[model samples]
Every structure is written in C-alpha cells, then in structure tokens.
Target: MDTPQRAGHVAVIGRPNVGKSTLTNALVGAKVSIVSPRPQTTRHRLLGIASFPQGQILLVDTPGLHRDQGKSTATAMHRWMNRAARGSLEGVDAAMLVVRAGQWDEADTFAYQALRQAKVPVVLVVNQVDRLKDKTALLPYLAQVSEGREFAAVHPVSALKRKGLEPLVNDVLALLPEQAPLYAEDEITDKSQRFLAGELVREQLMRQLGEELPYATTVEIERFVVDGALLRIGAVIWVERDGQKAIVIGKGGERLREIGAKARQQMEQLFGAKVFLETWVRVREGWSDDEAALRAFGYHD
Candidate 1:
C-alpha cells in the first residue's frame, strides 16, 4: 500500500479587482478570501481547494499587482503579489492569468508580461465578460495579446455571474497530473479561522470606507477564545495615522460599533457559533514602512 499521488497547484494571478477572489470562491464553493471593490483588497495568497468527481484543484488567490507611485502601502502590496506569483509558479501544474474583458491597458500588459515570464502552462482568463456589450469585440484584443505567446487556452468568463466557469474548471483539471488529493476532501481552504474572521471584518470596512482609506489598514486577531456556546474574539484594526484612526472610529464611536456588529454577524455565520467580537482602532504610525510591523502582520516573508 502506497500514498496516492496528488494534483498540483493552480495559481490565479491577475491585477487587482479583476474578480480573482470571486472566481476562487466560486471554484471552491465557499468564501475563502475577502472581496471588495477597492483595489489591492487581497493582501496575501489564499489557497482554496475545489474537489470534483475526477480530482481536486487548489486555487491560489493572490493580491493584485499594480505600479505604486509614492504610497508605501501599495508598494508593499505589489511586492506581496510578486512574491506569491513567483513562488506559486515554481512547480505549479498550470497558471491562470485573469484579465478584465473589453480593456487592453497598461495593467493588462504588465500582467501578460508577468505570465509570459512565468514559463508555466498558462491559461488566459478574460474575466467580467458580462460587462461586454459585444462578446465578439474581445477577439481582436485577445488575439493581439496572445499572438506570439503560448497559452493552454483562452477563456472568457464572468466570475460574478458564474458564467463560463465550468469549462475553465474542466480544462484546469485536465491539465493536472493523475494524483491523489493534496488536501483533505472536506477542507475547502488553507486559511485559518482567525484569518477568515479578520478578513470578514476588513471586507465590511472596505465596503463601507471605500477609497477614503488606502490599503493601509490591517486587522489582527489578538485573542480568540471559545467558552462553551459563545466565541470571544478581540481584534485590533491598525491604521497608519491618527487621522485614519479617527476616520475608522468615527464620531461618538457609532461607525466602529456598526463595523463590529456587521463583522460579528458574518463571523457567526462563518463559525456556526454565536460570536462576541470586539474591535479597536489603533494608530500604528508608518506601519507600512516599518519592517517589524509588516512582519508582525504576516505581510512579509
């Protein structure tokens, strides 16, 4: 009797807000990462495993890559994306480069370049096809970008509408070598409960705050204690400046309370237990630039 072989990893690399998290969640049939309309919402590589009748597919949801001007926070996020993308391609069976449909911009060009450099069996996924009025309009752009390059396949999908995903999944599985499951069939994601809870809080904040705050905020779970029926969790929301902290807490603590309540509701749904979540805003001056702070927050390698 020997251990069975396992399927290899599939890295989903793309620019920010291109529906990477949405596609990862859809593939896994669960929410493993926080998704916001804001750019660079995904700060780390989240592994979501999708199990099919044939085999398992491990999806790596990475942070969006973009050029940052002077924002230290954005610079760090881009570094994270580079790290994940490079590391994931090392021995991956295949890679999917997600690009927004109906656009051929600098960001898309950068993404294409990165994928070309990866040298792995790649699939070009044109996401947000639902936004395209004329689907045929995408052909010229796709053909132009893919002219001299080798892509296992080019797929146009709407991650939001769950359109054109089945084919993508089937194609990905076909590329994987015949092997045993890399992860337990029941385990859908590699993220911990604490990480998921923090992400849920951050997602709500991102939705409510919008671009008023950059990706300078981080949520850390200080304490996660389970006492019988209730979960007692304490988290600190770190901001880069006192002004940002003020904005997060808001006047009379109303906004902070609202964020906490919504986060608690989501946590309960995630944990399947009543949650008592306490969140506090702390100004950690220049946390983005501080190497110690970045390492402590699990942003750095």
Candidate 2:
C-alpha cells in the first residue's frame, strides 16, 4: 500500500538567537537563511522548502520576537522585525516554537500566546540540546514546560549538530494535509540569489563587527550581474555614522576586504558559481529609525 503525501507551511518562531534560522537551514538541507550570534539577524520572512519521500514541509523562517523597549531599542527596524515574526503565523498549518534548551523566558511565553491566539497547532522544538551540560535535566524541563501548555509534539533537537530531527520532522509532516509538494524539489528557498547575496554580506557584518555596530549597518546589493558562469556582485554597506563607517572599514581597508572575501565565499558555495564581490562602506545617518529609509533598504513587507 502507498502512503499518503502531506505538505503545508510551518511557522518557526522564537525569541532572539534561539537557533530558529539554524533549524530552518538544517531541515531544508541548505542555508536558506543567514545566521549570526546577534539578535534579529533575520529581518525578513523566508520560506525554506524541506522535502521528504512521503511529504514536504514549507518552513517560514522569521525574525526573532522581541519587545521595543526604551529609546535605544525602539526603532523602525525593531517594529518591522516584530511584525515580521507575528505575521508568519498567518495560514501556517503548524507553528514550531523554538526555544533554547534549559531556558524559557517571557518572550517564549509571549510567542506561545500569539500562536494560541492564531489557533494553529503548536510543536515545541527545544533546540541546542547539544550545549546542555546536564543531560538529566532534559526530561524534567520538558515535563515542566508541558504541564501548563498544550503541544502537538515536543522534541529536543540540536539544530547545529543536526541531532534528533528525524522524529521532529516526522511529527510535523503528519500535521499537514495530504497533498503534493508545494515547490519543486530542487528549490530550497523562495528568495532570489540577489536578496541572498545581500544577506550573506550582512551576516559577515554581524559576525565581524563588535557591540552595537552591526545593528546600525546593512548591506545593499548595488549590482548583481551574471557574466557567463561567474557572478559579479557589488555591495554597499550602509552605516549610521562616519565613525561607524571608519570602524567597519578598519585600518587600511583590511576589515572591509575580509568581510567581502568571506561573503563571496559563502555566495559561491550557495549559488554554485564563481563570485567577484566588491564592497564599499557609506554613511546613511539614522537609517534604521527612519521608516522611509527602512523601506528603501528592502525592509517593507
């Protein structure tokens, strides 16, 4: 007898840096979303298509759910991120609430409440289990979290090490309706290569920069030209101030060069083509706070 096929969207939601993007990439078997240690690295809602022999899962990777507190955190960018995170729940067949192993806070609770309000099936994915020092604490923590809340399934998996994901995927697939694949098997994500190129450069900025510098910076792909088998990409790194620009460029342009080199390597690996990436740092002056500027930087929904 032939098994039924199931396919639908699953919203991956969590607070900042809970490995939501990592889990999406792991399930899709590709880097569809850029990852960094910094919070709110994923500013857009992205679709990652994960295929199995019996079913397919369309994963919606969104920005971390966060509160805009005080003057510092209250910016147009922050509001947009919150909206992006909340907006992902719409029409999803299931919601996967990702949380760090051994830790649950107000933000996690808020996300769960939002999912409940949306009335979607919630699957609790406790990510980063490999980092837990005490393995004995896992069962107790799971029991404690499951006491008050209802979850269709709960699985402790390490998104980075790719452990314990088989059962998680199986259970998530069962939640969807029986249907054919929504996207082609070869297609891993809905984002274009041009959009991904900018994200890769921004990922480097987030990783290489220190403190709050990465938050004030963004990458714009000025030119993405396909010349034969090679990709020629030009990126403009926008900073909020002149001092930030100088710091990003570093001494004698070494830092900017390193950022470009690393980003180009990632782009090549993902696009499967040789890439010539050029980057320039420019001052934007409070672009993150200005809604008009945010839209110009591709932050619009």
TM-score of each candidate structure, all chains considered together: 0.91, 0.98
Model 1, residue 135: distance off in Å is 3.4
Backbone clash count for every predicted candidate, in the order shown:
3, 0
After superposing candidate 2, which stretches have Cα over 4 Å from the reference? 68-73
lDDT of 1: 0.82
lDDT of 1 by residue, 1-301 (tens): 6533447789888877898899998888877877888877887878999987778889988887665555545455456556765566666788898988877678877776776777778888989988988867888877887877788989989888888989988888878888888888889898888888889889878987858585778889999998999999999999988889888898999889999999998889877899999999998887776667878987754
Candidate 2: the clashing residue pairs are none
Q: Model 1, stretches more than 4 Å misplaced?
A: 1-6, 67-78
Q: What is the C-alpha local distance difference test score of each model?
A: 0.82, 0.94
